[model samples]
Target: MASDVIVRFDNILALDNFSVSIPRGVVGLLGPNGAGKSTFIKTILGLVEPVSGDIDIVGLDPRKDVMSIRDRVGYMPEHDCLVDSMSGLEMVTYFGRLSGMTKEDSIPRSHEVLDFVGLGEERYRPTASYSTGMKQRVKLAQAIVHDPSILFLDEPTNGMDPLGREEMLELIGKIAASDKSILVSSHILQDMEKVCQYVIIIDNGRSVAQGTMASLLDQDMTKRRMTVRGSPKSLQTFSEQIHRDFEETSISEEFGQMNIVFINDGSFAMILDMAKGHDVQVRSYVPDRLTLEDVFIRSMKRDA
Candidate 1:
């Protein structure tokens, strides 16, 4: 696990063991509120040192080589720290210079990053006059001004409307495509679901699950559940016939639908064929794919 690993927090054994590997590309650090996701990141960034165990970012010990790690890592903190008098470009340039960028390089790179984050025209506007979404973009621009290889984003979608969220997700996806690894910590499972291929779930400071979406959801008994509506009585009759003939079908009280669990990973074609043969006249059939929410709920149940 340590091979090709950029960050590792091994067996702290606190409430959360804090162990997971963040490979290249976009990986989500998913958890509910107070799940210690932020704390774990802070510990890794050397902001909050761990009491026991070890942590390394980019093969450099975060504690011993804090400066080296900071140089190569971009962090967009969750809190709002924009200065009222500073323009977006100024703020970005300031951070860039602080990160060791010379004035000549900082000025142009500030525009490049602000433009990359969709703040080109408004780069000169004071941050205090910016909207919430604009402020978020400013923070993002500053984080990437130094051109870090890794980005640690804390709730990048926070306070964003639906459109803003989508735009932010697209931007994050572009960053991932451009060869920078992103570790985004967020409580919003749906938002994270759209961007992350791999997820690391932590609960009460313990690593709950860490894998690809498919791998995490593979343990679910109900990987696919859908409701069919249009004619209640006909659906019920179809369901009853299926139950009477085949024992694999069960009625779901929650959704009031004929819930069928696939045995031995049966294909969807089987259900379609069964419906056609029975002359059920199904109005519609939809399959619900597994989501991060389902995996999180299952992990919570297992922990309980």
Candidate 2:
């Protein structure tokens, strides 16, 4: 939605030359703390104006088509934003009305969204009495009360137990499975991997990576990790021989298992033949697919 966008707060530039077009799907916004993620979201919501460049929120300019952007888009901020005195229904209904829904329509829609978010019974209870998970549910309910086409979910599973985190991630997966497109921002790489088809990685106010999740994580297909189960002595001897024979290879042994990384091993058949001849038991071997966390670290270090 932005092209060469530069957003600044006072003297600090939050987004520099940020040019990216979001496709229609669930996308992840990943970055470390203070990586200009919030600033970027605010700029799209029209809360922060770009110092120089244009913004198109779902085809409507945020400057001239404020209402269109406001109506079609939904946002659930990272921190707690619920009104303690208001019940879930009241809060969601209020946001629904703010989205241009009539009072009568807002009430039913609010209940529907609260129920959809697994908070139907808690809709009437005051938010102050709710747990962290319930509060998150309320926030999610309010964001979707108006049935927006796109949602900006910032840390939807910020503080929760394992079960709660899983539930929230599953709920997000369900939402993304529907027609609604979501831009989910979080530091939790596992949750992002679960729900996101595409990823946008940012660091220090600049985008370091953006592409399909599979393509980004599996960028280098030639290199791979191989695990072989065998005796320590056998694996040790095997490892030494391979290390001396192959270029750009490292082997580590632990608990009678061998972990090998082919940094740039060019020949798969030759390596397999060598291992077979050395009597190295092959437990499993597959092309290396870097985890999201690995990709984030490598990308940040590369950019740095």
Candidate 3:
């Protein structure tokens, strides 16, 4: 958790009065490049000192209890931080010991986490010879080898193919299932939507929006939008008929659909009646809900 945090690099400001109460769940940290997401994570880990404000990790002050915080936190950084000569098993075991685990405990734990990340026999191979996905998996193995209570995963799925990305996300889901608080930072919005229960969007080094996924996406529920399908001519007539009644209406004949923003839920029934009157045999009707990408774009534009 952080309150009124401000971090500056000489003349450049990286964090501008940023504040967030990260909940105990899989929370997504979303922002474009240079938006202070990585800096925020480093500040919480005590790797980057803030010029002002307080930072707490699981009830301990990051400034005063950084060493203690490291023991309870696992960080999987975005860039490559692997030893070329060490095998996957050796690297993870080394990090486990660094996290204060006994060599005896670190060995088996490393193997367990390596297996959890699907390294298998590859764990014995040198990391230098491993593929990008393997390297990412090895990085994950090292981070969780000590079984920390919280995880900071910065671009955990970076540089991986689609299958590898899905596998990494599945692993993250499993970690969250065990009740570990995870803060994931990545450019991939769809992946964030799949895993994150709460999301925080940052822009211009400031907090743009932060809340549960459902709440953030449903903030404008009063303006209902839905998609309708029918024959082009009938759909056109239906759109023209309803255009004057609704406050806002849009029809895309190219897609054979219409979008309407209505005042109340009752308007849906009225729409169905209008469709019937216009001879528009509706094939399908579904609510067009806002996605994480939509929320991110809107927030960034508003901040700009």
- Among these predictions, the greatest lDDT belongs to 3
lDDT of 3 at 85: 94
- Which is superior by lDDT, 2 or 3? 3
RMSD of 3: 2.9
Give the per-residue lDDT of model 3 (tens digit) for 1-304: 7889999999989999999999988999999999999999888888999999988888899889999999999999999999999999999999999999999999999989998999989888889999999999999989899999999999999999999999999999999999899999989999999889999999878999999999988876655565667777877777776677764533555566665544344556777788788877555555556778878998998999
Greater-TM-score candidate between 1 and 3: 3
User: Model 1: runs farther than 4 Å from truth?
Assistant: 1-15, 218-222, 226-287
Cα error, residue 6 of model 3, in Å, equals 0.5
State the displacement of the C-alpha of residue 142, model 2, in Å, after optimal TM-score superposition: 0.4
* True-structure lDDT of candidate 3: 0.87
Clashes of each: 2, 0, 0
Q: How accurate is candidate 2 locally (lDDT)?
A: 0.84
Error of 2 at 63 (Å): 2.4
Worst 10 residues of 1 by lDDT: 1-10
Off by over 4 Å in 2: 229-252, 273-280
Rank candidates, lDDT, best first: 3, 2, 1
Q: Give lDDT: candidate 2, residue 237.
A: 74
lDDT of 1: 0.76
- Tens digits of per-residue lDDT, candidate 2, 278-301, equal 778777667777788878888899
